[model samples]
Target: MNHEFSIESRQFNLWYGDFQALFDIDIGIRQGIITALIGPSGCGKTTLLRSVNRINERLGYVRTEGLMKVMQKNILDSDVELAQLRKQVGMVFQRPNPLPLSIRDNILFAHKLHTQSHEKLSRQDENNLVENVLRQVLLWDSVKERLHQKAIDLSLEEQQKLCIARLLPVKPSILLMDEPCSALDPKGTEAVEELLWELRGQYTILIVTHNMAQARRVSDESIFMLMGKLMEHAPTDQMFVTPACKETADYIEGRYG
Candidate 1:
């Protein structure tokens, strides 16, 4: 399927004070598809992901240069609202990290924050929102009877799905996942992988992963990064079957990390 949204970065650079983390990098992420960033640790995969959502700009002494645009809006622009950008592009971390509240409250948190922007959602609207997103993630059946229970009470996999559910109420245009399945067990990983496929039609997804198999399974396009530079990027099947770069081939063939 073709993407409806587009993301592009040109000569993007990132630095943590005197230390540079990302080299000047250029890439484009097609909307409505899963693009996976794969590489060894500290190679700037996460940094690139953070830059897409402008998360890196929040750090003190961190500086960015060049241009980053999402859906034609320049995210690097000074006038851009980081909060609003974050709402349009939601993120999911490696760990569950659900709030210390009831399941219902967790899903409603984003809605409550922007209450004035949206008409006051009646209880039924809230419930429908929760039910729809939960079902999309295949978690509603498991948690429906326990909506009032503490979020911490759910299983680790269920908690991760709940976090995903929380993002849906705000209707984000893109989903950024940073090693979302790294903390999961085999079963939990499969759950998240299945959820990703289910969500591809509704939102553009960009994921950073160290798991090559996971990338092969879930991503339409795969990007390989090494030492702060892009090594190779291609359709998932082609990349794994015939990597264009030696480093990418080595990594995928289990020759080296």
Candidate 2:
């Protein structure tokens, strides 16, 4: 219930039909900090991230129990407005997926949705929004001259940056990135990492990654999961150096996944 907490989950459980994916998970994420979720494949890292934003609610057999909140509002409540909640918390996926439209339109699409019902943005306002967010993601310089070009025509890394740019125009308070750098090359990964660091002051970020080095580089706090359970959560440096749990220490030391 603390206003400083951006995300909090209490006794959260998730199931897909007869299979239970997450079991009574409790976690809290502070505002304006990067929280990294690290775990081996099939350990439910991505599931937890998706649930935070209610993306998993789309699955027919998927059911969740307990409380999950963002900015002190209950996300699991049926009466909540999902559209508005999603605007407060945005997500970036493992692969880059840009719309078939032009670069300018991709960023404009969401802005139009959120702003249209209130008041339409002037042409100059729209242009400034697109340019500003692109610059924030460090893609403006390269794509400034080609704002009208098709989004699909850009390189993979550029497309990914554009996706991040698209989210920024809406001004979400929390950003969920699920293996965002997995598809990028070394240079591209570095660029995304730098962008994440730069965004720390403005947005609360939670990243799910298998790469320990990436977690250490961009995260202030770390949460480790295994077999659909939280093993440990601590400051990033301490989690890597002096993990409190034997399982966490063994996993980080490469003894076993």
Candidate 3:
């Protein structure tokens, strides 16, 4: 079952002051699949991921030319509301950055911010919302008993999962994860990889990772970028077995970054 493109970038160029970070990037990321963006450090993989949700704009010096569309709406247009756009596109950082609040409140925080009627949400409504998203991220069974515990007190893996769960209440169509496992141990990485599989077909996930092995394990499609330029984007198996570009092959072979 093929879904429509969740994100499309056409002739997209981004610059941080005089230094350009992305060059004419063009791709259509399909809905409901995990797509991995891989490259060496400073290769602009994160830059492109940040671009999808317009997070790069937070840096006042940054500028862009061309188009970036999320959910078929051209987000580059000035009329697009940042809050609504962010609600549709969620982002997770390299390190788990759960709020200092309790796990339950962390999950409800975004929903409360986006929702106009917090007082209207009954006691049962909030509890149901918390349980639903926690289960979605597979954190329910483990943290169910301590829903009100400080989110930071949880293990790194639990914190990461909570970060993901917190986004669900907003009903984002696309999730931009930048090295989500970079801060985790091997076991934690594996657990999150499993979570990614569980999330497939429900949310379009674009993840950036330096670990090619992780990319191969979790991604349906792989995109390799080099020095701010996209070298190749193809099915994960094909890209690993027989990359169409020498740049891609060399990078995968550890010959170059």
Which candidate comes out best when scored by lDDT? 3
Show the colliding residue pairs in model 1: none
How do all the candidates rank in terms of TM-score, highest first?
2, 3, 1
Best by TM-score: 2
Arranged by lDDT with the best first, the candidates are: 3, 2, 1
List TM-score per model, in order.
Answer: 0.95, 0.98, 0.97
Please give, for residues 133-165, the per-residue lDDT of candidate 3 as tens digits.
999998899999999889999999999999999
Model 2, 63-131: lDDT tens digits are 999999899988988888888888888899899989999999999877777775668888898899898
Instruction: Estimate candidate 2's alpha-carbon lDDT, on a 0 to 1 scale.
Output: 0.91
Q: For candidate 1, lDDT tens digit of each residue in 43-126?
A: 999999998888877787889888888878889888998878888888898889899999999988876876685588888988
Q: 2 or 3: which has the higher lDDT?
A: 3
**In model 2, which regions exceed 4 Å deviation?**
none
lDDT of each: 0.88, 0.91, 0.92
Range of the 10 consecutive residues with the lowest summed lDDT in candidate 1: 1-10
- Candidate 2 colliding pairs: none
The alpha-carbon deviation from the true structure for residue 60 of candidate 1, after best TM-score superposition, in angstroms, is 1.7
